[model samples]
Target: MALLETLVVVFAVAVVAALAVVVKTRLFPLREGEEPREDVAEYISMMVSVFYALVLGLCLVSVWDNRATADDRVQTEASALHQTYLLADALPAAQRQPVRDAARAYAAHVVEVEWPRMAEREPLGTEGWALLDRLRTAGELTGRATLSQQIAAQEVLAQLGYVDDARRGRETAAGESLSVVLWTGLIIGGVLTVAFMFLFGLERNTTHVILVMGLSGFIAFTVLLIYQLDAPFGATLGVAPDPFTRYFPL
Candidate 1:
């Protein structure tokens, strides 16, 4: 619903800008000798358009890569936890169940609790860290044990380490967002790019209006696209919990 509202707002702004250009042109007609300056205006507009395009492209790519990385981290974390669960089977019969249960509980918490919180861009809290610590503790085999059990414990700890790293990465990604400066640049640059279209006078008034409307609409659409991708886990197009479900079904 928020995304839909953003789209509506951007579209409305674009339409209003286009209308303003039309009204301005009607109110103050271009002078008879304005043709000589058009070449210079066109060159300046072209440069501004090009620079803005480059900035937009950079922003789009950065957000897209961040989203992809967030998805990868989720998948990696789930996979490592699943491996830890399986490694538990190699431990002593008494120790195996606790490790497996801890792993399962951690995965469940992530899918059930942390995911929703991430969508709201809120911290996952200490509960998740507590669960991870439980898993680590359960996987430890410091007491007198068989050689095979010792080796299994080592592997389990390693896998837990992977899970921890991935989880940290996921948390960081969830909290990540585009900087305010970048957003300011995108918004101001978009307005300038659209406003630049008004400088050149076209042969037909309809042509001018259509040109402005199209440029404004495209600029608005690109800005909205970046906004959606800026927060990897908070947007509708965000990374999902499919990885957890796939490996550790409820």
Candidate 2:
């Protein structure tokens, strides 16, 4: 729904901009005596276009990489939790169920509680960390144990460490976004790129209108795409929590 709303708004703005350009041309039709300096105008517009393309490409790549990294972190966290759950069998009979329960609880919390908060860009507070600590406590053996139990405990701890690291990465990525400076550049550059179309002298007014409409629509769509990708876990192009569900089956 949000994505559809965004698309409607962007396209509406583009249409309005195109109409404005057409009205300006109709009101002040290029006078017979005046001629557009195509040489200078084309050169400057070309330079502006090149620079804007570079910036657009950079923004796209940055968001794409961040989203991919966020996805990887989720997978790693889920995989580690699954490993820890499996290792519970090797622990002492008394501690086995507790450890498995802890692992399940942690996974469930992440999928049900923490995920919605991340999606909404809300603060996760300390509950997730507290749950992680509880999982660690459950897996640790207080008394002396056999070699196999000791090894299993250590492996569980190691898996938990991976889960911790991945969780941190996931949290960081959830809040990651493009900086203000880049956003300003993107907006200003797109405007300039489209505005340049009006300066060119076209033999037919229809041609001029068509060109402006196409340019405006395309630029608006690109900006919208970047905006959607900027929110790694909340926006239209965000990463899903399928990894967690795959391993821990909510």
Candidate 3:
């Protein structure tokens, strides 16, 4: 779903949950002597809050790191392609233009075609691989090439290897996400945390309602943020193709 739609759903759920708590409390009021055991409820709530906080922290760090790694892989791939293009200058006149053209085509395809597919978590077809093969073939030095040209060819091959590795990494990252079990924990934990607030509420109903609303809203916001960050190449809050555009420039 779109980010705004997700947010609306989350907020609606939070509001409904808060309203349910309010209605339940009004229907069954606490007993007069219940103060004696209120501390226990508070302690349990505190523990749950701490545990949930830890889980949220860990999830946030993991998703943020994954996003950063995805961006780095893009930059690495672009740099490798750029290096391969520049190294063509050291190749023989017959071999130089073809390699450069192949490198350009690969970069163009990645930026123009593959990037959009990645946003949708779709596969880039054999065309990109075919372009890489073309670049590799063009960089191959034959019997007539000089020693320097042969060395350049080897260097170009090495850079191509880097590009291939980084491209694979990018593709893997585009499809990466937090597991379903973890998502279950996150959602259930948030609900339980808010529900616990209703167990031992404030003296004033208005104050209690406000507290529940604020806490639930914050939890929903955090969950939404994590969701957005989970898929590094998702359409929302995803890494852009700036690296390719910067290096290749069309």
Q: Pick the candidate with the highest TM-score.
A: 2
Pairs in steric clash, model 1: none
- The per-residue C-alpha lDDT of model 3 at residue 159 equals 98
Residue by residue across 28-53, what tens digits does model 3's lDDT show?
Answer: 77887765456767998999899898
User: Residue-wise lDDT of candidate 2 within 23-90, one digit each (tens)?
Assistant: 98899888898985579678989999999999999999988899999999999999999999999999
lDDT of 1 at 122: 92
Counting clashing residue pairs in each candidate, in order, gives 0, 0, 0
> lDDT per prediction?
0.87, 0.88, 0.87
Off by over 4 Å in 3: 1-36, 203-210
* Cα lDDT tens digits for candidate 1, 152-180: 99998898888889999999899988866
Model 1 local distance difference test score? 0.87
What would you estimate as the lDDT of candidate 3?
A: 0.87
Which candidate number would show the highest lDDT if scored against the true structure? 2
Q: Residue 72's C-alpha lDDT in candidate 1?
A: 94
Please state the error at residue 113 of candidate 1 in Å. 1.2
What's the TM-score of every candidate structure? 0.81, 0.82, 0.82
Candidate 3 structure, TM-score to reference: 0.82
